[model samples]
Target: MKATHQPPTHAPVTTADLLRMAALYLRQHGWTQGTYYATTTPTNYPTPPACAAGAIGIACAGHTVEHFTQLDPDTLADYLATLAAFVDHLDTAYPMFLIDDDGFALDEHTSPYSWNDDPARTAEQVITALEAAADESDQLHLTGGQN
Candidate 1:
């Protein structure tokens, strides 16, 4: 007899849920994704180089399982499962930015110039990028309301 796999108790993961879960995980584990470390000293605030030359921002870090969240219930079990799968396959949940730490000050793979000038892309464009990333990874099973 074949053993049937049991479905996850947590709900599906969504874009909004992803952010929330990430924040929650960060808070719970005291894990900083270089998010707290702004780009600039005074926070360039809509200007170029939000942080220092090698500061951590939102473009150089890799995503993890804790980045995922459930829809109905805000539990982290679902997200953890996703992360587990990602690790098993040696796949990154998503490409993210982080602080290098050993460099100047929280240094990581940051853009040479400031990314402020670049106007924010439309929601559709952002969604498209996410979908593409998920497709490439082959583990991102996005639901309808996941956006």
Candidate 2:
């Protein structure tokens, strides 16, 4: 007798729902590759100059499953809006002058910094890039490995 493996079934869902499911799946499966953490402070860099004293901000990160899934347009828009709002709030509330993958606040840029000028716009741009990547991933999945 031969064993049969079944592929996971994922129904059409919202981006938020998919994100939640991915998070849950990663946690349940103990998949460390998809998991990540960001620090509000400059932990990756050296102290003092690189990291200002008492500079604090929010650390946000998430993981996506290996499976490719289409994102509901409305949900994706909502998620992007929420992210923009959060970034705007953080920019207004904190003295965050620097931002990186590690969420570190390193040396402050000189005047006329692009990100400092408009954090919300920057956040939106970031979300847009991510959305494009997601779309590509979905396409690749649909095509069965062709990127």
Candidate 3:
């Protein structure tokens, strides 16, 4: 007998899920520096992979990393604005989580885009950062926030 695959139940897709998908995208497609993606479009998978922020943008595009596709501007903006995804961005409520290129919160506000493009940045570092953000989001959602 053959079995069919079932779809994921998370209909609305949370910030944590978006972050995790970004990490998965980096793991599977490799990583890039100096660009959100070599191609920078959800309609097409990036070549030579995507930067940390780029991965996040790709994640914002679809339900899954492998199937990421174009999302309307408003929808994409909504994903990018999620508190978890904002951890590394500037001037957000998460100033404490704003980190430098080294992924440390040195009281310096470095955007994820700039951090990902740093010459010294590694793919592992970027991927790990995304996963960490997801974990934090998970904890927040489980402990004190609405899903």
Candidate 4:
């Protein structure tokens, strides 16, 4: 008799989940904390706020780092969405220096694969991948000047 093969299972990646994952990534990279709000701007804020208020925001060491509105559909439907773009921006700006899920450091000289085709991947998976890369980056930073 032959055994049956089964595919892995993953929960749907909700907007809240994405937000939490992003916050975790930010914290891992030295961001202090994050806040979530229902409106883009707080009603009681004075003019010229230090940071633009949004549905979600994160700060690092008392400095505002990021602020953005919520994702539509409450789920990550495509890589072209704002949240994904934000992640890309963070990766580029801060150099999370992530290795691939397979434990291979992504070649800085090469382009990464477009995630548009695999929108079904869960937020947890994405965070895990990023965290692994960040860990590697931290190790490299601690051991040598390379990053």
Candidate 5:
């Protein structure tokens, strides 16, 4: 026999869904890899010890189970923008994603997941990023449409 986690009821993930799930996971259960939390999982989809990338990926693609037969990707918000505007707006929300107190955020130069997995990384930081990404997504929508 094997222990398996259940796929959440939420489906057809939206940007808001991704943002909300990631932030909430960090806030409530938290990303266990970093911080002083004692929870870890040899299996997958451990909600009590959520991971930023795992949460985001699960919401985005259901990495652990079959949550959705179709991903609509548009239920989150009601706007769109150009790439230039997006970059500009991103700085407004998450300029800190690339910078730390001593400056230079990423030391490993791996991926955002690695950044999330850093033991020095705080749950608040991941939560902020998730919230900021949602904000940036909304900001992009102000452009009317992709440009």
Candidate 6:
């Protein structure tokens, strides 16, 4: 009798799944990122990257590190608004990034791919990506201000 070999099972995450995971991670970090985001249509002007790829990041603007300690509600709100726009801009840009740059594809036979070298990007990393996207958007320039 001949011996049979069984292939290993592999599961790759989808773009939608990654987006959902990113939203959950952001919420866990206390930035208040919403579960759903709207996409800008036509033009497709700005393309952003997926959360898994660190393309659409999070950020807090007009709020300094000291503000958090002071507990300024107004400033916090402003920061949140900026962060939302930043994320939205990212949503707009992500598709573009996927189109312009080589797409991220995982082979079922190969090992799974990691978003960041750390495998899991920290909150700081998310903020950094958001800032980078904002810069690319050219809508707002993020200066190293804290939230």
Report the number of the highest-lDDT candidate: 3
Encode model 2's per-residue lDDT on 55-136: one tens digit a residue.
Answer: 1101111222111123346544544443443344335444347557798866543221233334353423423333443443
Name the 10 consecutive residues with the lowest summed lDDT in model 5. 75-84
Q: Which pairs clash in model 5?
A: 79-141, 80-141
Report the Cα lDDT for residue 14, model 6: 25
Give the per-residue lDDT digits (tens) of candidate 1, residues 45-137: 322222111111122222221122312243344433433332222224332344456644342322212221124423233233333433443
Stretches > 4 Å off in candidate 4: 1-117, 143-147
Per-candidate TM equals 0.25, 0.24, 0.63, 0.27, 0.49, 0.26
Encode model 6's per-residue lDDT on 75-125: one tens digit a residue. Answer: 455444444554454455432222224655432221111223234446465
**Index of the highest-TM-score prediction:** 3
Writing each residue's lDDT as its tens digit, candidate 5 over 24-60 gives: 7667765666422324544443454555654554445
What's the distance in Å from true for residue 72, model 4?
Answer: 28
The TM-score, computed over Cα atoms with residue i paired to residue i, of candidate 4 is 0.27
Error of 1 at 31 (Å): 27
Error of 2 at 22 (Å): 15
lDDT of residue 79 for candidate 3: 60
RMSD of each: 13.4, 15.7, 8.4, 18.0, 11.9, 21.3
Task: Give the range of the ten consecutive residues with the poorest summed lDDT in model 1.
Answer: 50-59
- Model 4 has an lDDT value of 0.35
Residue pairs with clashing backbones, model 2: none
Those runs of model 3 whose alpha carbons end farther than 4 Å from true positions after fitting are: 1-10, 39-48, 63-74, 82-108, 143-147
